[model samples]
Target: MRIIGIDPGTGILGFGVIDAKQGGYRLVTAGVIKTPAHTPLDERLAEIFDGLTEIIAETKPEVMSIEKLFFARNVTTAISVAHARGVAMLTGHKAGLVISEYTPLQIKQTLTGYGKADKKQIQEMVRLNLGLSQVPKPDDCADALAAAITHAATTRLGVV
Candidate 1:
């Protein structure tokens, strides 16, 4: 199964594609969709939607795993991210892909066996899980990959 994971943000949305094969995972691509800070919020959202649509077309993923929104502070930032995330989800839905969302805690726990694992731990595990030489650059990209890995693990266990 080809899965695309998304760590959505207004300024920088991260995405990763992985193929689950023979009970293992292989990285296909990982990157960020960055919008200029000075750009208008509406335009940034449009950019996110368009970019995600293109990615869906290119990757041809069977499903998408996305990070669920959670914020204790910064309501403004959270709202913006939620908008971007909506666009990402919409793109996936339009492409006829099954979408699943996981909390950051769930992703961490699934990848490292600890819900409160640090960023370094998550990155290292993502790298190790995919057999990559080094962690994927830009922390958000690694997080997206983690989301994908979490879905793969959970689905395999019949939890999702």
Candidate 2:
């Protein structure tokens, strides 16, 4: 199965594509969609929507795994991220991909065997599991990959 994972943000949306088959993973692509800080909020959102649509078209993933929005200390930032996430979900829906959401703890547990694992640990495990030379950069991108890996394992275990 092909999965596209997303870490949604207005300024930078991270994404990773992974293929899971025969109990292993094949990394397809991973990167971030960055919007200029000076751009207007509406324009940034439009950019995000267009970028996500392009990604969905290019990857044609069977499933989309996205990080669930948790309450954040900064309400403004949280709301902006939430809006970006909504666009992401809509993009996946329009692309005919089943979408799944995972909490950060769940992603950590699936990737590093501990829900409290640190970011470095999760990144290391993700790299090892995917047989990649190095961890994907920009932390958020790695987090997105972790979300995808979590879904892959959950499906393998028949959990969701």
Candidate 3:
């Protein structure tokens, strides 16, 4: 199975793709779609939608796993991220991919066997799981890949 995981933000929408087979995972691609801070909000959202659509076309993933939006102290930031996440879900739905949402805690737990694991631990585990030389950069990208890994593990165990 091929999965696309997304960590959505207006300025930087992180994404990772992975293929799961034979009890192993292969990294297909991972990166962030960045929008300039100075760009208008509408334009940035459009950019995210368009870029995600293109990625879906190229990757043709069977499933999409995305981080569930969580509220922080900043309401404005949360709302913006929610909007970006909505666009991401819409793109996946349009592409006929099964969409699943996972929390950060669930991602950490599934990837590292610890729900309270720190970012570094989770990133390291993700690198080790995929046999990569180093953790994927920009934190968000690593988080995206972690989400994909989490989904793969969960689904393989019939938890999803």
Candidate 4:
């Protein structure tokens, strides 16, 4: 199965694609869609939508595994993230992909055997799990790949 994992944000939406098989997982591609810092929110969202839509088309992923929006201390940031998240889901749905949502805790636990694992720990696991020589660059990109890895593990174990 081909899976596209998304880490949504208005300014920097990260995306990773992986081919998951019974044998193992293979990284297809991973990167981020970055809008300028001062860009208007609506324009940034459009950029995200366009970029993700193109990615889905190019990669042709069968499923989408995305991190669910969560924020305890920053309502302002959370609201913008919510918009990005919504756009991501809509793109997946329109593309006819099987959409899956996973909490950050679930992703971290699936990758590192600890729900509260630090970003570095999870990124290291992502590299090890996929047999990469180095961790994926940019924290957002690694987080997106982690989401994909979590989905692969979950499905392989019959949990998804």
Which candidate leads the pack in lDDT?
1
Estimated TM-score per prediction? 0.98, 0.97, 0.97, 0.98
lDDT of 3 by residue, 1-160 (tens): 9999999899899999999897699999999999999888989999999999999899899999999987869999999899899999999999999999999889988987888999999999989988899899989899999999989999999998
As for candidate 3, its clashing pairs are none
Q: What's the lDDT of the predicted structure labeled candidate 4?
A: 0.93
| CA-lDDT, candidates in order | 0.94, 0.92, 0.93, 0.93
**RMSD in angstroms, candidate 3?**
0.8
Expressed as tens digits, the lDDT of each residue in 117-157 for candidate 2 is: 99999999989989999999999899888889999999999
The residue-level lDDT of candidate 3 at 152 comes to 92
lDDT of 1: 0.94
lDDT of 4 by residue, 1-160 (tens): 9999999888889999999998899999999999999988889989998999999999999999999987999999999999999999999999999999999999989998899899999999989988999999888999999999889999999998
Write the candidate numbers in order of decreasing lDDT.
1, 4, 3, 2
Please say which candidate is ahead in lDDT: 1 or 3.
Answer: 1
User: On a 0 to 1 TM-score scale, where does candidate 2 land against the true structure?
Assistant: 0.97
Q: What is the lDDT of residue 59 in candidate 1?
A: 89
